[model samples]
Target: PRAAAAEHADQLFAGLQDPALYRFIAEAPPTDVEALRARYTRLATRRSPDGRQAWLNWAIWSFAEEAYVGYVQATVEAGEADIAYVVFQDYWGRGYARKAVAEMMGLLREAHGVAGFRATVDTRNHRSRALLEALGFECVAIHADAEVIHGRSPTRPSIG
Candidate 1:
């Protein structure tokens, strides 16, 4: 399922606080902690009309602090799942996202009994595309105008 801009905004702001930090990859301006918290709480506790969760999201905190630097949002598709992620600006340019993604993939493979994972990257997002490729994902194709690069993760070798 697709998420609302407000929900994504709330999470993006909360994950990357400082004005200087928020400017890196976000499309919106920075937000104060209070506004960020309120919106986050609302979105976090929000339930669908059917009484089910709004959307599934997960976070990876920064060390022992409540502060977070990485998180993932996934949607179920054809009995499988597709994931997307964002890392804080302070942590950008580092290999943290790659490391975190690798760990998440391992956990998902075990817990979900999944055979593969997939991601779509903007053509201009070289860094993200590279990270995906480094994780064993191959570019499957480019969507119209090459705006999106679809890639898939390989299945782990089976053990005897």
Candidate 2:
């Protein structure tokens, strides 16, 4: 995984503009390329490991179609990391998010030695909740309207 770069701004902008992709996400999609570029620029600088946190991000790509699809990220603090992923709506249900997230979990475990992962999913996003459950995450808490799921490396029995 590599840091997000400005070169990816165009495809990233296009992917984020899909309303279906952001339906369950808290933040609405940026309305223009300039906004997307600014966001990407901020993400790029987060690659440097500060004492308080480590931010990792990667652009999702489809080799078969030779295009950028989406992104996956993990923000590590203390001994745990919060993970999230997004794929263009057109690529939804194709297992791209699953593959990317699984690989990220492994990378975070092996490379960073993170003890656990946390993911916040919209309560109504059953698909995302199911994916996390399949990965052995258990819903440990709820905040506002979102469910907070937690998982450890090697995985434990899932809880509701």
Candidate 3:
């Protein structure tokens, strides 16, 4: 079962191909069942340390967008204290993304003492940019390939 989940993770992100999304599960080698088991068990049983570091992936509801309809992934990085996410293609143009992002920000602020966060979105990803804006993130910088967005938590964010 653990092997299967690991395989599924690899297969799932392989299809998406965004490095940000893939980074969450890319190191898992499906053929290494023992390693997969260890990793899977840890993720399955671990609790967020009051939100200092958290990773989540959830399915978006059907009937809102594309056939893949609903899926969301988020991570609050430890050092830089950035939050990032990506949604499935079919789920575009829906409000699910904004809602999920806002919620993740809440989790980061309430549970992790996160004061600020950053994100890098592909330059052409207007949908993602809009979602970030709706969540109160500010467009801070534009890289050659990506636009950077930042949000401040209600309280002072942790440096760690």
> lDDT for each of the candidates?
0.57, 0.82, 0.53
Q: Count the backbone clashes (under 3 Å) in each candidate.
A: 0, 0, 4
Best by TM-score: 2
Instruction: Write down the TM-score of every candidate.
Output: 0.61, 0.88, 0.56
- Stretches of candidate 3 off by over 4 Å are 1-80, 154-160
Q: What is the lDDT of residue 117 in candidate 2?
A: 92
Estimate, for each residue in 1-160, the C-alpha lDDT of model 3 and write its tens digit: 0112333443334335444343423233234445544544454433465755555444334453323333444455563356555555444455556666666566657766667778777777677776666666788898786777877553422211
lDDT of 3 at 26: 23
Among these predicted structures, which one has the highest lDDT?
2
Q: By summed lDDT, which 10 consecutive residues of candidate 1 come out lowest?
A: 151-160
The regions of model 2 sitting more than 4 angstroms off are 47-50, 155-160
Error of 1 at 8 (Å): 12
Ranking of predictions according to TM-score: 2, 1, 3
Clash list (residue pairs), candidate 3: 60-70, 60-71, 66-90, 115-157
